[model samples]
Target: MRIRTRLLLLSLAVLLPAIVAAALGIGFVYAEERGINQRNLQETSRAMALAVDRELGTREILLKALASAPSLARGDLATFHEHARVIAEEREASILLSDENGRVLLNSRLPVGTALPALLPTAVQERRDAGPDVTIVSNLYRLPRNPDVPPSFALQVPVPHTARPHLYLAMTTPASQLQALFEQQRLPSDWHATIVDRQGVVVARSSDPAKFVGTHVRPELQDSMAAGEGMHPGMTLAGVASTAFFSRVPRSNWSFLVSVPDAELRRTGLWASALLGGMSLLLLALATLAALAVARRTAQPMEDLRHDAQQLGDGAPVQARSSGLLEVDAVNEALVGASERLRRASADLEHRVAEAVASFEQSQRALLQAQKLEALGRLTGGIAHDFNNVLQTLTTGLHAARLGSDDKVRRLLATCERAVTRGSELARQLMVFGRVQEVRVETFDLAQRLREVQPLLTGALPTDITFTQDVTPGLWPVTADPLQLELALLNLVMNARDAMPHGGRLRLRAGNSVGQSPAQDLPPGDYVAISLQDEGEGMNEEVLARALDPFFTTKSVGRGSGLGLPQAYGFARQSGGALVLRSQVGEGTTVTLVLPRAQVAPQEPAPAAPSGGLRGAGCVLLVEDDPLVRDTVRSGLEVSGFEVQTANDADEALRMLAGGHCVDVVLTDVVMPGSMNGVDLARLLAREHPRLRVVIATGYSDRSIDMPGVRTLAKPYALHQAVAALNEAMAG
Candidate 1:
């Protein structure tokens, strides 16, 4: 998943439970608070009911005592009235009495016979309303002359004296005392106790009496008064919701109502829940944010790793970043290390690949050389088969003409012979091209040889150009194929000449090279470096690198043969040397031929010899594959006064040898068209003709041959060359 999505999921995973728990926890706290509020309200209601019951019990006892007193019926002015007055004073009440006509006869605080209109009317009304012998309680009314005082209750006791249900007397307990009882009642903060008459009128309230007392008691209060028991119920006064409980005083027919606002009971719980929930939400939100931050920090390392991996995959270098968290830091460190290793490994791989390509190219070059050599061998064999016959004919014809010679005809024959010689030279050049030439290794001073060729090089160049030879003195001699080395130098010098067509200076130089350094791939050793340089129009780097590639020529048309540099390169490698090239498009080029230096013996002065060279004293065996060639050679020997025995092939020569022909030399064709060539024939006669000197002559060469103690002569040779070769063979 993507980073944003993953972070979101992680945040949710961590935060989900917190939010849920906070909500549930808040709910639980609210419920607990609500329960506590309810319990407190219930306790306050009971407290309020007890307080009301005590106050009502005192009022009812005061009312009963007044009703039984005989003076309480008469008046406060009579003996009974004085007694009643004393009783009222003791009870802290107001009292009055009435006659049979329902006129007030005595007033507890009045003079001897006072008619109080409110009191007399209240008494008469209670007398008229009373049944026989029944005590009745009256509603509160204002006394006639005492309107300032609140209406007091009429308690009528009908005596068996007069017709109007006897005289009725009534008394009132102090309303202030009744109200003080309710007001002092203990209740919860939101609860209040109130007293109500049996008619459901509000009388005394624990709250503000002026406002609440005149207000009708709640329906639950009325029910409590009617049932004479307590009841708890909910009420709405105006819009405020409250819980009301009521209980009545049993004897007094008064009610106690405790009203607790539901809002009050729930306020603490609601506020607590609000405060807790708000805090929890804030805390949870912060926690969620923190969790997201932590997750992102942890994931940072992975993100960097992924990005770096992508870069590497796209072939860029790997990169890493740092994070502060420990695990993230460790992961980042690992990734950083991995990236570095990958970079190193990748660089190593690229280098190895380059080396592998170079190795493959070398193998391909070797394979191509092998294939070319095989093909050349076949071609050479075919050509030699044809040319041998032609040579035999020309050689024989020349012999016959010289025997019957006119000087001009002989000269003409010499010209023909020259043509044959030139053709033979061409054939040899081709053989060398096929790498089929026999090589003889001998120690020679390469530097001296180069010095000798310097003057010749100067003569060959134009006058405007100068040849400078920096031949290091005392340079070591080297063993090499001298002829091929000379050819390679010629090709390089000619290439240099073409580069500097404007006649620039050329340098032929040799020195030791520190190879396999960054500057060169040659090892540190003694080297014979023959450098040919010119202020020439040089090649670019692309061309320089591919300069030795076969058939790659920048020269136009026949102006150059591409084989020059390639041949030089091949020859150098075959001779255990290296050819390094350098050039820039504007600057000149340097072709350095590096060969391992060799040691040589110091030269000794020689004296002149006798006119004729030494000759062994034995008959010479001539093994010639061609009859005409063999006869011609035999005649030359006879003329030279040397004894000779001849055969057309190795087998015949062997038979003649077995027949005891005494030979000082075995002269034979090296590439005879027979079961055995001259080299094999020489081997056969080697022991028998131990004193024999073997000389080989051929028009072709097989590069595979490694015969020793042999001197090779080209076909169509003059008499002098044959004599010279024979002497050299004997000398060796």
Candidate 2:
């Protein structure tokens, strides 16, 4: 072999690789360009679809508004036709009003007295016949005035009150409006766009719409799009091979298409590649001289920009300096802007974190307060149950003494009885705070009920304080226990009186709320708000936080029981309502009850009852769990001239009955420790001794009990009340 042949072989090795590399690079560039063009066509199709959907939605809203016009409801066809004409001309559309049988009564494009025509197609008429209230939207169809006129579609809505049944108000818009929407998207000039309804009918076309509108789309395109929105490569309606993308319009049974011709894209890509090949030799000559200078100029600035970006990521400030080159200067400027934004962002993030922490602390405090209130409520309920038993003994013993004592002794006994009555009221307040008190719900006008209690409220206030009322005249009726509402009102009024030590104004206001505000917790509906506003020393946030807790009072020790606010809160919640309190130090306080409204008819008022009480004449058997209560009640009944037998519990009472004791009535407590409580005992007696009378009495009774054909006596009852219950049971 020759030395020259060996050198030629090495040169061929380097040149062949360079030639192959250039060919591969050109192919990669063409593939990337094709992908970019495909994505751009898809995005353009989706944008056009969205724009057309918005246009149709605005038209639908307009049709619905015209359906609610007063002129149409009043049977004034002339006025309604004129009004529809003005609206149609302003929006560049046609309007029609039709009767139940689909006969056109008025068309905005023609004179009002023109002979009527059938305005709806067969498909639309079938839907209306099935359900007259249905909204009917039509596909594109030819205009009736002339075949040369543009195609149009109709939007129809039911007119609720018109001269004819199943009347409709329809608005017809030309296909030109949606074609204009497609054109407004500023898509590439060579791209073709069309809007089609669900039935494959072409409603609008960007190119030559006069020929394509109201025509069915080609069978090939319809079959491809039937599966859903997507892209495909196929021949277009005009017999040109193109890449087409389709998308569905939101909230409508319509779709849009964007098509780009493959021939046009291929021509552009070929021309670009040819120009690049021609410029390669010229660029090679210049590159040798520019590379050294370009590298020297850009190295420092590029490095500086990179280092500053890292600092910005670390939450530190950066200052960027520019290189003289155009591209490098652009990068430097972006870095500087980014660094400044980073500083501002860091400060904003710190501020947001601080606010979040403060909110979390406030929520934690509120949760703790609620838990404390719940625990206190449970404890208070237990104490109240035991306290009522003691009061029952005192009440019955005092009533017995008052009946048999001399003049002076009777006066002393009356004082004891009054004290016992006040104690019983206190126990009742505890039950209310625990949310265990039963209520008898009824529907009544809240405004009228407030007026009935106005006199009592005014008399309870101090002499130095003036009272004012601002009740809305025709407020909605509310469903609640009337007795509980009156007691809650009295409690609020008394609290207001105590707040103003010297003198202040107290106002009671009632109003209706539509529950539109987002800050309210009530469901979306109507409510009645009753507010008690007082001008006195208000509470601080810490005091307000625990204001609703049981036995939580700001007053001096012996001056308050702290049950007033809790009772009001409990009652409101138990009645499907809410209580809201707003107070500020050195300002005033306002407490409002948001009670739900009810739909109930008014009933005639009943006559008031007489004052005299009933008498007793039966042999009574008294059964109670507590010994003190049993003995005191039994002694009272014996003194009242009724034969009395006593038992400590239901089991003992059942034993006495099993022994064949003679008794006219059996009185038992509803809650006991044994397996058979008072309600169970009564059920047994009804079955075993069918003719024996029964009376259920309890200081704290469970509301779940079902006592049929028996009288009930609420305790802390006086001797006279017990005797009355006995007589009532005997008579029944």
Candidate 3:
């Protein structure tokens, strides 16, 4: 409709065809280059094939001439041997003469009386089967007397006598001769030459002859060779997948293969095309840019309006400007009005975005808190696993010391035993905090379990503090992991003791509660409330509000891990219960655990086995990656009258077993070095030696527990526990 618009459209219409023509020209040039390269490769392959054919033909002629020597026709054997030796020395090949029955009369490589190998007779028979005067080129083989030499082929010809050919003459040439033929050709370094006999075994390769010669050609090449000489893409004998041009050797079943890697073949054509295409593209871009510039200059009125409209769309202030044309002036005025309205709308949107951002930040803070707790739980689990193994060694060693001790020594060992027991309890508490320990819930009397834990509680309290317990008679039984509940109670007691550095009263009380109003956010149900109250320095409202947060401790750094209260809270919530705390500074702190009461009565505890008389038998194979843990456990097992052998990891353990070491039980750590870890080792042993028993000992709970059908001994186990586990495995 407009002159400027029509000019812009006309320029693009002319430029588009030019760009297409340039692309077509580039593609044609590339195709022509590829065709030339393919022909060159075929010619090179044919020349290499001709070279190999000439080498074989020359060897055949030399063998025929040796058969016609004058000394051999007479009865003078020494003269014939001397003539053969001279011919063999000149050709640098092994020459042999065999009787019609295939016994060697003379061999250039070996002594005069040495017997010829079966290969010579086979070649003679093949020649006879093919009719008269046909030369046979045998497959590659090693010389009979000199096996150390490279692989060689036999060129066999029957000596023509008045009698029916009593003697057969053969010339042996090593594949190195063929290698020389390939080397003489002037070809590209990237091209590889391979010559294969009719059997598809490589007689020579130009690239790394020692590595590829005597190997069979790749199956793809074998298939292609059957159809005669041609160019095909296949894997080479060097194991590189490539394109090959092959030619059949003249007058022979052998083949000559020339290979060029696909990348190398395409490199030259692509480089030439890339140079030409880049120049063409640069010129085309320049032409298009020039055309657009001229068109924009001719259409100044429309260009000014378009620029103002773009500024309005991007929410930037648009100046009140217009082209002198009547239609563009009217459009500019409308855009100015639209721009004002958009500015107001954008302001309103900004106000709402501020409020949304504030809400999002609050949600992010809460999410970050949960993630922090989860990360701490993982850290605690890993630490507890390693700590448990250390304590296991300490526990076992202390028990061994206590066994043969004097009265004074016995008292010291007792103290050491108490400390080891405390260390093990600490590791278990860390596992609970980490949420790594699997919970086993059973109906249990709450009061009785707390009473059993009281002695440990009292031992942890200060001498000036007084401890008291009051449980309502016939308290309601709660269904939970008793061990976890006991640990939670101990945590609360320890907090109360720390509150009262000076003398104070610590009381444990349990009662039945039936309403939801008492504890905020607790479900309405019948519950047993176990409370620990201390008359000690306590928390204010501010400190108490953030008390349950993980790593939020008022105590000085290094004095507290800040995980105690959160651990108790996690345990209570996971057991379908709630933890509540109420306190005021300088008055006291009272922490209560409110658990839903079980509907049924509690089950009685199982009778304990007599651990004192427990002894392990049968030879035990101990596998632990840690040297200290392994050595300590081995000493303990020996003291317990069990035979023990040790390995650092599963691989060494397997080596020992394979070396014929006898063992009835395999005690292996779950994680070890090598491709096979303890779990993998157990599975292999299960199939290979069904009679052998496996005891998987692990300090880590996560991966170890997931393995099915294997007995796991959690570390640091006392020596007796390990022995008990082994005995159980042996018994099963």
- The candidate that wins on TM-score is 3
For every model shown, what is its TM-score relative to the native structure?
0.35, 0.35, 0.45
Instruction: Give residue 477's error in model 1 in angstroms.
Output: 99
lDDT of residue 253 for candidate 1? 52
Error of 2 at 459 (Å): 99
| Candidate 3 backbone collisions, by pair | 388-716, 392-716
Give the Cα lDDT of each candidate. Answer: 0.64, 0.75, 0.77
Residues 1-732 of candidate 3 have per-residue lDDT tens digits of 765768867877888888788888888888888888999888888888888888888888878887888878875668888788888888888788776666677888676666646544557666667655667778777656777988988888888772654677888887787777765786678788888888899888878888888899878778888877788897776667689999988757789988999888888788878988998889878877887788777688787888889999899877777567788889888888999999999999999999996885565555544643653443454345446655765666665554533643344344445445556655565565445677788998888877656655665566578889999987899998977886677667767766787888999999888755347877687888988899989899999999998766676433344566887898788878888999999889989888888989999866433222457678999998755467667767876779999998888998999999999899998756567889899998888888888999877756634433458888768778888999888888
Evaluated with lDDT, which candidate comes out highest? 3
User: What lDDT tens digits, residue by residue, belong to model 2 across residues 1-732?
Assistant: 433344444444545565566657666766677777777777878888888777877887888898888988887778888889999999888888877777788888787789967764653565565477766667777756678867777777788765545687788877787767765677667788989887899998888787877788777788777766788788777778987789887645678998888976666556666566556534544553454345445366656667877887887777666567787678767877888888888899999999996885565555544643643543454355456776787778777765553643354354455445545555554454345667778888788888756644654565677888999878988889866887788678878988999989999999988854312667777788899999999999999999998767777633456777987888888888899999999898999988887878545456333210334666888999866677767767876788989888889888998998899999898766566889889999999888998988866655655567788888778889889888878888
Question: Which parts of model 2 have CA positions greater than 4 angstroms off?
Answer: 1-10, 99-101, 110-114, 123-136, 143-148, 160-164, 266-732
Model 1 TM-score? 0.35
| Candidates 1 and 2 compared by lDDT, better number | 2
lDDT of 3: 0.77
lDDT of 3 at 663: 94
The RMSD of every model to the true structure, in order and in angstroms, is 41.9, 31.9, 21.7
